[model samples]
Target: MDPEPRSAKGRRTRARLVEAGKTVFERDGFLQARITDIATEANVSHGSFYHYFDSKESLFREIAEEVEVRLVSMDDIAQDLTESAGPVDRIRAANKAYLAAYRKEAKIMRVIEEVSRYDDEVRKVRSKRDDYLAARLESAIKRLQADGLADQRIDERYAATALGGMVAKFAEMMFIGGARFDMNTAVEQLTYLWANALGLVPTADQKVPAKSATA
Candidate 1:
């Protein structure tokens, strides 16, 4: 059944709540965040918060939904792929887009990661997102193999899992392990790794330059 329609003001208030929820969750994290904190952050009353959300968990799920959608929006991915010239280019584009989104939503992602240890519902949400990204990478790997652009001996699914885990963990380490991450360098190296793992040749544009004799 279709859900009941909310008035314009109701929609605006819910948006404010969501924005405030993200801020509160990012600052305080899931374990430390409270309904009152989100309500205060939104400048809305406690009753209003309850009216829109049954509990903090529901609100967080909503935020997670938004984050996942942004992270792997097929429309955005298609645009990125469309502009790419080859497998290496496509991989680089995907990495750049994922990294950009991860940087922006790092805090919330950390919250989700931490809370998922004991929260089954949250863990499921996280797992679903991971699965979606992995599947996309797996498909890309298969395509490369089909075109004779990648190593036929590589197991597409396992390779996809490894690549996805490496990128996700790298981003996490940068945020929580105090690693100094240079975005451009990280993306370049990651692209190189992906290309090498698939046994694909780098494009001429990606080739390393030889030192000049004068030097």
Candidate 2:
């Protein structure tokens, strides 16, 4: 295993390698990506690759971890679903942030999904990451119920998991499946579906926000 970098420049170089690894892995895949290629892409010495990561797979793991972090770092949407914001605004904010983040990392995410199919380590990382999202969504659903926005009888866990699945699949279909998708439409429709499914009744104005109907 590689030792931790103790200097600022060292840390920067290591981060560059990780960034390059994402590009190389997405372009060449996990099986075909090489340390030399990553080094070349990062404009660092080939030996420097080993200074931070023990192997290509280790680098891949780090990249996968980064992707996982991006997937759930919904700081823009905030987690207080029961905040003073109305259900419609909250739904729009969360859906918009999630879709935007997914679009930004779509390529690397596709690579992660593909490699996870046959790599146990990658699969575990992906599974854990997704479970975290689902758990958060489940909590949010419960909050909605408490706020009287969602049906009290709805099974939060299953509903959250199913909704999470639908969103992920829709993103993959649009971004990874090479389909021409309108992001505005996706966010609006998806937000509507989620809000309605949770039993939230939209007010006349909230039923279709201005931006929601544009696309």
Candidate 3:
């Protein structure tokens, strides 16, 4: 169900609550952060918090939802793919897109990933987000097939999972380990990995490259 309409000011007030709650949870974790802290952060009463969210868990779920929703968009991805100079560029765009989203909201992503390790409720939300990302990758793969832009040798679904798994695992590692990973390295390594796996041969026009097939 949609969130009930409040006056614009009231809606803004509730939004602040959700946003603040998300920040706190990302900083302190799902179990550690309290609704009272969120209430104070939002400049709302603890009573007013109930008016917006049923519980802290529900607010955390919403934060996870917001982060996952930004991960992939097949529609935008299609444009990036076609406009790319070659398959290598397309692969880079795909990786860059994934990593960019990951880096943009790594905090909330970490919260969702970390809490999900122990909580069934959080697991459900994380599963939903994974499903959504998988669906988008599947769609993007289907579009590539239809356009004759991608090779038919590989199963697009399988390729999507393989590719998605690589980044997903990397992000999970970043959440777990103290690492100096950055977006550029993710874009470069993931693109190289995907391209080499796909047996893609890129020409000079492609901004970066994987080495020759027989080399």
Q: Which ten residues in a row have the lowest lDDT in candidate 1?
A: 206-215
Which candidate achieves the best lDDT against the true structure?
2
lDDT of 2 by residue, 1-215 (tens): 34468889988889899999989988888788889999999999998788888899888987898788887787877764556678777777888888888889988888888888888998999888889989999998998998887999899999999988888888888778887767988888898899888998767776564543322
TM-score of 1: 0.88
From the highest TM-score down, the ranking of the candidates is 2, 1, 3
lDDT of 1 at 113: 77
Which number leads on TM-score?
2
Tens-digit per-residue lDDT, 59-96, candidate 3? 78777777777776523556666543666777677777
Q: State how far residue 11 of model 1 sits from its true place (Å).
A: 1.8
For candidate 3, the TM-score is: 0.81
Clashes of each: 0, 0, 0
Worst 10 residues of 3 by lDDT: 206-215
lDDT of 1 by residue, 141-167 (tens): 999999999999999999999999898
Each prediction's TM-score versus the true structure: 0.88, 0.90, 0.81
